[model samples]
Target: MNLKVAMTRSSSPANGLLFALTSAGLYGFNIVYARIASFTGASGSAIVVYRVLLMLVLVGLVAAILRSSLAMEREERGKLLLVGVSSALQGIGYLSSVAFIPVTVAAVVFYTYPIIIVLVSPFVEKTPLTQALVAIVAVATLGVCLVVGPAFSDLDWRGLALAFGASIATAVQFFAAARCTRTGVVAKVFWIQLIILPTAILVSLATGQLAPPSILALAPFAVTMTIAGYVGGFVLQFLALGRISAVAAGILYCAEPVVAAVSSALILNETLAPLQIAGGALVLAAIVANVLLEQRRRLKDAALVPIAD
Candidate 1:
């Protein structure tokens, strides 16, 4: 191929879907990887520390390569750094939960962030609280309940609480990310990940948790897969965003939970029961519906605006 052709991205929508779906799969695999780390004797806190350090290194390299600057106005930059707090919580909560529950279950619950965002956007983003959104939240909530099953007593409550708490933090993360448009994405990612350093270290000290992985956790295969899943996933996510609308990306990202379930089954020998599978499908459907619903409302609002001419 010529240089220009090689330099240009594929304009085909399918290409974007491929990138988005692959990223989703990588993210899905990350859940199982965290579980593996925990099973190999790494604390949840330690997993975050290790992963955060890796991300900081990778993202920092990318930022340096592109000569990206973090010189944005204080407010916008502050918003970006604030995203790290929720991100750390998101990582810590879900990773911690996987130690006590199946990765599939932790993922299923954690994926409810969009649903939580829908429930709170009215107060946060001033988005209208429409009936469709309410119904979407209800359906997704029911799906989570079914996935968790009625026997709540038997399951570890700590995992459920942590996973759900992560979901809430993820919702808040989305809001912070939305308001942080001034900084370049790469720069923001690096800085945000760097912000996780002090917080993660502080968490390690506060909880008296180890910050290093075991020998098994750092094995060639384990380290390779975890790094690929997170760092690679982060790269492909941006590639997908560059190629497709955020709305399309959001819809395709419903693949994340599906990926988590399948990968856990294949690699980790963990499978969801029939009812739980059905529940996951319901949750996915609601998430897609929510994305579509929001897009339609935005379009309608745009049409209502009178032309300046």
Candidate 2:
């Protein structure tokens, strides 16, 4: 099916929200697995390489089953290539940072996407920042700081820097994706993973951490789950983004760390202090508030338009 058909089939507000939440849950679970693999002595680059390689195979099977040919126009191929390279860079930077820092710290730093989106909005959308959005942004920033503050002294500065850098790369990838979708979704994803496969492999090998998985080892299973989660999460993201506005989608994505923290506590037995819990609550509230306001505005516009028409 075409992208438009897929999106239209699930474009209701309720469906969009569910799809976005599903994406976040899958991504959160993936993060938990990645952290587990990392703690078990799998190098970050190695984990990424394994997951990307597996995802390539899995996604290929999915494409074949769907009878979808993975192809893009010559002009679009360049953008897809850039997206792939950016995806790899984001992965490398994130993994490298996690090697030095706590998973939560790295996660918080990478979750700075909302701020980046807000900063980039004027240039891309030619829209002025409203006061309410600015206030919510401040709340979100404070929440991030609170969440990471207790662990600040223990954080690896280099890791923090790399993690922040990765956030920038990811933000660019997201913005670029909004433009790239004009061509095709699966094609873009296929091309991005194509580049990711080699980039991840090269980084893994260069780090001297590219040991093939042992038959007796559990890391392979973890990597397999990670890749599965990534593919599902990404496809859901494509679906959600196509139906919702970028700002709304970005705000919803900002809630990912909360989901991550909860999953970390449950899966990894990680603890969050009271302050951290409160901070996470604030972050959730900020996202909820944004969505509520947007919904209200849409409703108001709809109610007024019928009388005028």
Q: Estimate each model's TM-score.
A: 0.74, 0.84
Clashing pairs in 2: none
Candidate 1 structure lDDT: 0.68
User: In terms of lDDT, which candidate is strongest?
Assistant: 2
Error of 1 at 108 (Å): 6.4
Off by over 4 Å in 2: 1-14, 73-75, 100-102, 148-150, 154-157, 296-309
lDDT for each residue of candidate 1 in 1-309, tens digit (9 for 90 to 100): 443443342333446557767888798787677667656656657666777787877777776788776455577767766677888887779767876887657766776775667666677767676777677767766666555554433568899999999988877766676566556767666777787878788877888885545543454466557767887776676555545544345445556666666677788787578986887787678766755665575456545654442
Candidate lDDT scores, in order, read: 0.68, 0.71
How large is the C-alpha RMSD of every model relative to the true structure?
5.9, 4.1
Task: Estimate the overall C-alpha local distance difference test score of candidate 2.
Answer: 0.71
